[model samples]
Target: MSGIVDLTLTYTNDVAGFSKEASKVLDVDGWNASTLTFYSHCGTHMDAPIHFNVSNQTIDEIPVSNFVGKAWVIDARHVGSKGLIKPEHIHQDIKDKFVAGDGLIFWTGWSKYVNTPKYRDELPRISEALALWCIDKKVKMIGVEPPSVADVNNLDEVTKIHQILLKGVVIIEGLTNIDALQTNCVELIALPLKIESGDGAPARVIAIEKYL
Candidate 1:
């Protein structure tokens, strides 16, 4: 492999209710240990079927092999903020490369607005038709740089899209540094914390570029 590229977003205590504090300081004549407290879905995370389907599988129940696979990063930077990523946005060349069980990542250059309000308000979302198209392609997972794959302001639509994808595919959100990847295809390794029966958990995702 050429090298591994980190695709996870840095977690901080910036968001209200999410905090990382020093539980023990070395200067206080004790071992230094920090306590981190945050939502399971915060930062770079993976969503399980239970996130939308309460009766479905949780993150812990998912097979370990599912988190690692061949991934394709589709460039959709031409999509405008608050735009829809339609089926046509994915060209035939990219579609012809799809194989069952492959992981798909959309790069829309939205990670540039990570901490800004625009990140939440103006993210490009996948259209329902495009989402179903992925499902029909039998993809193993779908990832995006945005916080959500659906319209966050539209609860009904959000739920619909989530249900559609979560039926058989994993959903990864809040990814960053996608533009740093040197290739469109790579080995993706995104493993989430094993929270038993938990809905979803933050993940440490990376892309490995194999030279040979």
Candidate 2:
């Protein structure tokens, strides 16, 4: 039998200050509907090359296959708040499981701070060397439990890491529930909304696992 795990954060007004307005109500319009006001990159989202690359390629232009692939979850919980995630953190065991075109997710146990003031301030960042390692491995996509791959306060570093990773892979950020994954290896399916010429878009990400 196979089971699915949802790896997305619930889009809420309290989280990231995304707003929602009731457009139609059951008592007045005989239906219930609301208009969402949030940034395209808010919540769990995917970053297209255009997000950091100069070219015109956007989220809608990326192939669907890039968002779905075999994923390996590397345990990075040891990384402390505001610490750097270095290449050595991966170790040989995790590196052995890496295959070209595989999607990689780092479980840093950082999702616990979501919706808090310290969430952005205390994000653990990926080192440039680690980013290069991923590039060398030809990873298809990279996901993290943090809001970004780099320190949010450091604009220069953020741009550098995004540019490096986006050169050959998609990046998924603001992911949650990664710690709930029962296995290290699973099928990752993270599809973003198709928005024309969009730099990035929020996504509904999940993992599918088969049990013996």
C-alpha lDDT score of every prediction, in listed order: 0.86, 0.87
Sliding window of 10 residues with minimal summed lDDT for model 1: 10-19
What TM-score does candidate 1 get on C-alpha atoms?
Answer: 0.95
TM-score of every model?
0.95, 0.96
Clashing pairs in 2: none
Please, what are the lDDT tens digits per residue for candidate 1 over residues 1-212? 38789999888876433689889989895789989987987778999989988356999999998898988888999997998998888768877987999988899999888778888788899899988988898888788998889888889988998988888788899898988889888888899999999899989999998722
Output the number of the TM-score-best candidate.
2
Angstrom error at residue 92, model 1: 1.5
Segments in model 1 whose C-alpha atoms lie over 4 Å from true places: 15-17
RMSD of every candidate to native, in Å, equals 1.5, 1.3
Task: Give residue 60's error in model 2 in angstroms.
Answer: 0.4
- Model 2 error, position 106 (Å): 0.4
